[model samples]
Target: MRNLQHYTDDAFEFHKEVLKSKNTTKKDPSYKERIENMDDAIEGQFSAYNDNFVRNTLENIDSYGHTDDEKNDLLKLYSYKNSVIKNLKVKITTTAANRIINTCPNCTISEINSFDHYLPKDEFPEFVVNPQNLFPSCTICNGYKNYIWIEGGKRVFLNLYLDSLPAEQYLFVNLAITGDVITTTFYLQNNGDINNDIFEIIETHYNKLHLLERFSANINEVITSLENTIISFVGKLPLDEIKDSIIEKSNRDRIAFGHNYWKSILEIELANCVEYMNRFVTID
Candidate 1:
């Protein structure tokens, strides 16, 4: 999820929106569960999260001698569940730290537990509403890669908000007609400005997000196109002729031709996808 920078008022407005939806959820599936989950999430945004939070609040109230302002502050904090009715006396005054509030952009879920569908709420509950926690992934992506906890050793929750590394190199190649393919080499000789940075980002994106390397990613997607062309040629032949035609076409090694076309298409789609990648890797 991209970082969301909202004005102070927007957060309160977001809370009101949450309340209205919560009130109207009786028309949908698992309304009670949804509210409970939302209530928990809301509490996390406030002070104590889930059950641990409630116990802590009670303990705090009992242990400390309260000032008049402290009692009033707690009152406002308690009323915040209503979102719209949150008394202004509860405005956050302590830190100038930029808050990184987040919620999954894809959260249209009607079920309570399903609300944090894309977020690792069970593990990283504090980051549940953090914008960095939200990723622009497909539903299939979110479901398939659920809580990708890389096990073994000291287990830590997987971080999507990783600092990307610089690009070491980026180069492209095409098979030569009769000789070796063009050895397009982009070297990380001198220190280019952002080469390493871009590389790090791509590497992280590749490993975490499963974006393939250029050789694997770019060439593989066109295998079907190559198959289609070869099949079409063979389909026009007799049974005995089909085998020969298929062999003949494949032996010609037109996979290079397919690669050329694919590379051109990719360049058109994102002009700097290859060139900029190389530029960063190649130091002056």
Candidate 2:
């Protein structure tokens, strides 16, 4: 998963603008109360988020006299197309794309198509417009991650904006050949330098996202495409030159995308396998 920079909008200012919006102020007592004490609420929200103390913050906000209708109103603020929130969403999607090829940080495959409330707005209405809590995500990852946070009392996902993704190479892929078919399987290897907490978080994130199964299912297309390219070069180039060219492409992919990227890892693995490389030589 790629790391995301939090949006730069000031939370207090954003909330103030929301309060001032005509739609928010018309016949809304909860909106009025939120406007009155937005400073405190915003501060508490940030503190809770930074400390990973969402349960406590949820409890505190539960006392804020927000009716079901009011909570729904707050949620609607995010849906308003003309709101500053829409601008912030665009900025987030653009920023993530600039950083990592428009891929979802959660899935690292699909193009980001929606903003996911990292903390569900239903549970944390006060943070509905909080830039830090919004994440640009693909529809698949966003749908799969609906309203899930803690699982069995442990945080089951990493906050891309807050958590430091371990720079060490932890993600790996193994290539296996059965008969004439090649299969790829994704895995995460333990790095001694990575703390247990971070490791557990990454592991949980992978499992919760079902990334392994997803990557494995999709890798065949890549393998087939690679084989087609190799076949085109079979009679045109010497075997050693062909191997060198493939290795060069693999290195380029690894540099363009990080070593842990599924494509890069797969390419690197294939480059090292002499048997796999030799299959191209036997073509034609």
Candidate 3:
């Protein structure tokens, strides 16, 4: 997984814009007054989130604005997602989003199409419109990670804004080739490079998001594409040279993506597989 820069928009101002809009008041008559009354507490919660994120104590922060809400009227704040007033809907795609607009940070495979609440809005309604709490993600990853943040006193997923993703290799794949068919199984190992606690969180991120299974399912087409690319080089180069070229391609991919990028790692593994290389070796 990749880390992302936090949203830098003025969240409080945006919240005010939403609250002041006639559309918002028309939809939920009581929400404007209720939220205005709790403005201090809401701002405090924002401060708490920033402090907790910096201190790595997010799990310790208590849910605000939910202490007395029996009917959950505060949840209407989530309608900011549909707000067209003052072009607030565009706020979902922050400047940070442009960096990975097509690719998902959570999966690195799928196209990003939605924003996911890092802390579920249902449980932390105070952050429904909090820009810091939203992350751009694909629909599948968002669905897989729905409403799961902390469990057993540990954060269940890596915070893109807070966690520093290691550039060293952590994701690995074992490939099996039988005749013309190739199959792959992907898994993660720390390689003793990352902190144990952080690695555990990464493990949970993968498991909870079903990343490995998803990667495996999507890799066959990639493998076929790689094979086709490699075939083009068979008549022009020696087997050893072709493998070196593959290794070079992987190095470039690692630079473009990351050390553990599934495709880059897969290319490295493929380059090292003697049996696989023999396919090109005999062609020449």
Going through the candidates in the order shown, the clash numbers are 15, 0, 0
Q: Which stretches of candidate 1 lie over 4 Å from their true place?
A: 1-9, 23-119, 125-132, 140-145, 149-192, 195-201, 213-284
Order by lDDT, highest first: 3, 2, 1
TM-score of each candidate?
Answer: 0.33, 0.78, 0.86
Estimate every model's Cα lDDT from 0 to 1. Answer: 0.33, 0.70, 0.76
**Tens-place lDDT digits, model 1, residues 1-284:** 22222123433334434445444344555543443444544444533322222232211211122345433322222222344332221222111353322222222111111212133544444333332223333443355457753333211222222322222223233332223112221112223555543344333433443422333434433434543543464435443344444445443432322222223333222222343223223232
Candidate 3 regions with alpha-carbon error over 4 angstroms: 18-31, 65-72, 79-100, 282-284
Error of 2 at 20 (Å): 6.3
lDDT of 3: 0.76
Supply the TM-score for candidate 2.
Answer: 0.78
> Which stretch of 10 consecutive residues in model 2 shows the poorest summed lDDT?
54-63
lDDT tens string, model 2, 217-263? 88877778777877888899887776678778876765555546777
Alpha carbon deviation, residue 151, candidate 2 (Å): 3.3
Residue 110 of model 2, lDDT score: 85
- Which numbered prediction scores highest in TM-score against the true structure? 3
